[model samples]
Target: MPKVTMNINGRARSTEVENRTLLSTALREKLHLTGTHIGCDTSQCGACVVHVNGKAVKSCAVFAVELDGATIDTIEGQAAPDGSLNVIQQAFKDHHGLQCGFCTPGMVMSAAALLKDNPKPNEAEIRDYLEGNICRCTGYQGIVNAIMAASGQAVPAIAAE
Candidate 1:
């Protein structure tokens, strides 16, 4: 067993895990971060997304040992400093971005990372960037709208700014 340490959701954690243990497993099983869902064993689903060192990554594709000493942010850490919903999460709720909600956590995490880097992404850019995320329920239009709204854009009746 390889003992790995990671800073998750602003807390430092150390776990003795198997060498091949996936990051998603470490999060859900060890740290109990169930908000990061495991929708697929394959990495193509993007349902296990989380921020590793401030960038979004598919948790299913990453090994715990590889993330040793890295800083990770799960959906639980996305809340505002006051413990209120973050802009992206609020936008998702306001825009009806989720249905079954299985893919929502990953979607929000990915959008948060995207908005962190590019605060004002256009519609096409938003679509292009979200190609990796797969939403099984909402048909994706609402997700795009939510992200655009959260990024501070004047779209429809939504007050993005």
Candidate 2:
């Protein structure tokens, strides 16, 4: 077992984990930050996305030992210190970006990363950037709208149901 030390959600954490332990496992089992879901172990699904050193990475694909001394941010950390939802989160809620909620954590994480790098991504850019994240519900219209609104861009009108 390797002793890994890292800053998680702005707090210093040290834990002993097997060298083969995935970052997702360390986050969920060890740290109990279950917001970072594990939809698939093969990395095809982006449900395990998290920010490592400020860049989004699939936690299921990374070992805990590889993240020693790194700064990791999970979905649980995306909210304000006072427990209010962040802009991206609020946008998702306002625009009905989630359904079933299984993939919301990853979607939100990816959207946050995209916004950080490109605050005003166009529709094509948003689709391209979020192609890795799959939402089985809502057909992604609400998700795209949420990202647009979060970036301060006008959300295109959605058709009436």
TM per candidate:
0.93, 0.96
- Model 2, range 1-161, lDDT digits (tens) per residue? 78999999999999999999999999999988999999988888798999999999999999999999999999999899899999999999999898788889999999999999998999889989888888777458899999999999999896323
Q: Give per-residue CA lDDT, model 1, range 1-161, as digits (tens).
A: 88999999889999988989999999999888899999986988788999999999999999999989999999999897788998899988988888889998899998988888899998787777788889988458778888888988866554333
Q: Worst 10-residue stretch by lDDT in candidate 1?
A: 152-161
How high is the lDDT of residue 12 in model 1? 93
Q: How far is candidate 2 from the true structure (C-alpha RMSD, Å)?
A: 1.8
Candidate RMSDs in Å, in order, are: 3.1, 1.8
Per-residue error at 54 for model 2, in Å?
A: 0.8
Looking at model 1, residue 147 earns an lDDT score of 86
The top-ranked prediction according to lDDT is 2
Segments in model 2 whose C-alpha atoms lie over 4 Å from true places: 159-161
